[model samples]
Target: MFVDQEGPDPNFSAIAAVADGRATVTVTGEVDMSTADDMLRAAMTDDVAATTLDLRRVTFFDSAAIHAVLQLADFHGPKLTVLPSAQVRRVLEISGLAGQPWLSD
Candidate 1:
C-alpha cells in the first residue's frame, strides 16, 4: 500500500508504503514545524509490524522533526528504523540521538 500527502506547496512530502509487514515512510524536502505532524501521521500506518522512516531526501530538519522521530521511536521501539540524510543526521547528532539503536548505519 502507498499513501501520498498533498497540499499547497508544503515544501515537503511524505509517502508511505507497506510490504512484508513493514511500513516504509519516505520523506523529502524540509521537515520543520509545519511538516512534522504530517510526516508523523504518514509514518503511523496501522497494523504494521515494523516501520522504516526514510529521511534520506530531507534537506532540513528542525526540533519539531526530532520530536516526531522521538514519538515514533517511543511508539515503535525496536521495530522502528530511521534512515537519515546528512541534514537530519546533523540534527540528530546535536540532539545526541545519533547513537540510537533505531538509527540505521
Candidate 2:
C-alpha cells in the first residue's frame, strides 16, 4: 500500500530538462502548482545561458510558477534565457524579469 515519489505524476508528465550542453533547461510540460518548484530548481544548474529554457509545450502555469521564475533570475546571472509559455512569460513580466538583466529572450 505504499506509493512512490521518484516518478513524476501523470498530470504533470511534462519534464524540465537541461539541453544545449546543460547550458539551458528545456521545459516541455505543464508548470503549475505541482511542478513549479521542480522547474525553478532545474534552472539552478550550471552555465545557465547554455540553458535555454524550452517551454514550447507548456500548457498551464500558476502563481507558484511565477515565483519560481523570479527565483530563477537570481541564478541566471546576466544571461538568463527564458523560453516560457505565453502564460509563463506573463508571469515573468509581472515579476519584473522582462526588463531585468537576467532575461536574454
Candidate 3:
C-alpha cells in the first residue's frame, strides 16, 4: 500500500508490505499532524506477528508523529521496531523517547 499527501510544504508518503506474518512500513518525507494518521494507518495490520517502521527517509518529524509511533508501540508491544531518521532521532531525543526499547539501531 502507498499513501501520498497533497497540498503541503513538505510532502509525505508511506508504503506498507506484509510477508511471513510480519509487516514492514517504509515512510518517507514529513510526518506531522497532517500525515501522522496516515502513517499510523499504514503501519497497522491485522495478524502480523511483528511490525517494522522504516523512517530513515523522513525529513521532518513532530510531536504528532511521536504520538503515532507511541500508539503503534502500545498496540504492538515488543513486536514494534522503529528505524528513525536523523530528524526523527532529534525529536525523539528531545521527547525522551530515544531510549525506548521499540527504537532500533
The better candidate by lDDT, 1 or 3, is: 1
Residue by residue across 1-105, what tens digits does model 1's lDDT show?
433355323668999999999999999998877789999999987799999999999998989899999999988889999999988999999999989999998
Clashes of each: 0, 6, 0
For each candidate in turn, the TM-score is 0.89, 0.64, 0.89
lDDT of 3 at 84: 92
How would you encode candidate 3's per-residue C-alpha lDDT over 18-88 as one tens digit per residue?
Answer: 99998999999988887899999999887899999999999999888999999999989999999999889
Tens digits of per-residue lDDT for model 2, 1-105: 534454444555434465555555666666766677777776677643455556656776667777777676666655566676677677667766677654546
Error of 3 at 26 (Å): 0.4
Winner by TM-score between candidate 3 and candidate 2: 3
Return the TM-score for candidate 3, rounded to 2 decimals: 0.89
Estimate the Cα RMSD of every predicted model relative to the unseen true structure. Answer: 6.4, 5.4, 5.0
True-structure RMSD for candidate 2? 5.4
Clashing pairs in 3: none
Judge candidate 1 against the unseen true structure and give its global Cα lDDT, from 0 to 1: 0.90
TM-score, candidate 1, is 0.89
**CA lDDT scores, all candidates in order:** 0.90, 0.64, 0.90
